[model samples]
Target: TGKAYELDFNQIALDPVTGEEQGRRMWGEVSLSRENLMPFLYKLHYSMHIPEGFGIELGILLFGIVAIVWTLDCFIALWLSFPAWRGWRKSFAFRWKQGGYKLNFDLHRSGGVWIWGLLLILAVTSVSMNLNVQVTRPLVELFSPLTPSPFASRTPVSLDEQKFPGISRDEAVSLAAAEATRLGLEKPAGGVFYSPEFDVYGVGFYTAENDHGDGGLGNPWLYLDGQNGALAGTQIPGTGSAGDIFMQAQFPLHSGRILGMPGRILVSLLGLAVAMLSLTGIVIWAKKRRSRVLSDQRRRHAEPEMQAVS
Candidate 1:
């Protein structure tokens, strides 16, 4: 057993570093926000069932969901964050003057540290224009002069107000295309979708392009002129704007897919970790509750017999 090539049970290490670590691959290098760190990762957190580019309304909903998860994660995070919490009997809200300081502060700090990793992922990823890159890397190569986004401003078109019948869908689309070309946007990737509520046939365009012309590799937005085909102005998806490119990428980064498959996998893994930590914390709490109940019952049952001296 001295140094033979044959297998030796006690000679090996339990946890081995992966090939990635050997390659010196770091999340920070590709991340736009390399200042933070997260030890967890998950898949669904990187890719979800949600439709793409739904907008801020959906964003708020997502926020609510993650917040709830974070609160639950606190128990797990707190456990990992503060080993001393095991002995903490005070309120999670500590107050020095009232002698409640120890309890609250312990819970607060521990809970914060537990979710801090997740928070870093969320915060850093939300600002990237496209989630196609890592937080440490720019999603797309930045232009030196930083050309104005083609879809930045809308070209106005005069339309028939009372259905004057002068303008047709063809004219509207052609005008949109022309204006798009003029402003240097990729050919219109979207067509028209009429909304009854608005009474206007809006011209739409998806932003997906490999040539890297106007927007990034996402879907097209819209331009709503009148049925008379008068251009009100250029519009973007989810309230379209040249500024939207940067904004949309942020959500993906927060979810962790901005870098590619690896990033998505990492985010998904983190989600799983958060889920596991929550479940474990709940079980631990339940076990403690059961133990307390048994102890209370045993003590109460033995109480009356101990009154001998009195």
Candidate 2:
């Protein structure tokens, strides 16, 4: 039901030099050469294609809850499937001699047991992101230092605040760059965004000097006051509070970017495994139902013959 951002021709336009901007045929008309499925997948995964905004929100909330509950169920199933010390070796092996149903059952059970940890991590993180549950914040806070407080510059300005003359974006960027070097941020400056809500310029950059230098999460950020080139604070991932690190890790982990290419491949394969498990489960149920129906039919036919003989 959802469409890609690139396909929203009404809201977007193409420029010869800078493509895809807000306007209609400013420089030249743009056309799609081929179909792109990334946007479709994104919308489907997030359940954002619902007719109305409220519907989309409701769908995400319900989905997050279901995922979390299902994750817990998977954990229970894995625990129940655990074999004794003597059976540990056999538990990992699949019996090829078994029939289709038995094999399916074993695959479902064994796969669940093997990948349950990853599934749980993904599920919990999904809940935290979609549901906005601060599960990690409290745990991290207990063990780590406090995160920097939000920007609170008392100096106020009118809504029509001038962008120039005070502190240019370039100045803010330079300060951020210097700060990054001092903090030993290995990655180059990611990018910068202007935040009107907080009247500050935010710069995002990555570093490989922290607890989770695996690059699975997003880069840390540096916040500077828009009015003047004053350093508000920096959210360096490597040196952040526990809560900050946890929050930072969510996006990368969710998208499989935290662990690089290998992590992405692993997550993709796990997704396929989940799909297979669901299909096999449905197949098993259907076969059982069909067998029950045949048994009932045979019993009804035999009942009349037995009565006549009696």
lDDT over C-alpha atoms for residue 121 of model 2: 78
Query: Tens digit of lDDT per residue, candidate 2, span 1-310?
Result: 2322344343234574867554532111232223334544565676544433652466576666777787688767766677576676555666669868878877777767677778777887777776653344455567775565445334444435533336777888898889878878767666677665567888777443532334446566778877786778777654666567777777678767688777778888988988987987788789999999999999999999999999
Poorly placed runs, candidate 2 (over 4 Å): 1-36, 51-56, 80-90, 133-168, 196-200, 206-217, 226-233, 291-310
Worst 10 residues of 1 by lDDT: 34-43
lDDT of 1: 0.47
In terms of lDDT, which candidate is strongest? 2
Candidate 1's residue-wise lDDT over 206-278, tens digit each? 4433212222333344454455565555534334343444554555555454555566677777667656545
Backbone collisions counted per model: 42, 1
Q: Rate the local accuracy (lDDT) of all candidates.
A: 0.47, 0.67
